[model samples]
Target: MGLVGAATGPSDGRRARVRIADVALHAITRRAARRIDHIIGDSTQARRATELLKELADLLL
Candidate 1:
């Protein structure tokens, strides 16, 4: 859970706090990507989904 934040910074109480909104966005992006990947024989929907995922991923980066 808190592993990443704990591991990234100094042990001298300098570790950054994790933002809840960022975590939620990441989880949502992963789910959206999976949904896009699972689309079967639907080019239009798949393309739109891919575009949306790309936009969401940009926020992450």
Candidate 2:
């Protein structure tokens, strides 16, 4: 059978947005250790996510 397209909903939009934000956050967090201000130009959500990720990393490390 061929692939079928699924209907999109609000949750789908939210998930897509979250995924994009996560990618940005990860990139910033990975690079920030070497360049602290590199992620300053990103969106607020990305920055907030990065902060949370950093906290989690610190806890785990």
Q: Judged by TM-score, which candidate is best?
A: 1
lDDT of 1 by residue, 1-61 (tens): 5424333346656666554466767887798777434554588887787899999999999
Give me the runs in candidate 1 sitting further than 4 Å from their true place. Answer: 1-38
Give the TM-score of each candidate: 0.37, 0.32
Please give the CA lDDT of all the candidate structures: 0.67, 0.63
In order of listing, the candidates' clash counts read: 0, 0
Output the lDDT of residue 33, model 1.
72
Best by lDDT: 1
* Error in Å for residue 20 of model 1: 15
Clashing pairs in 1: none
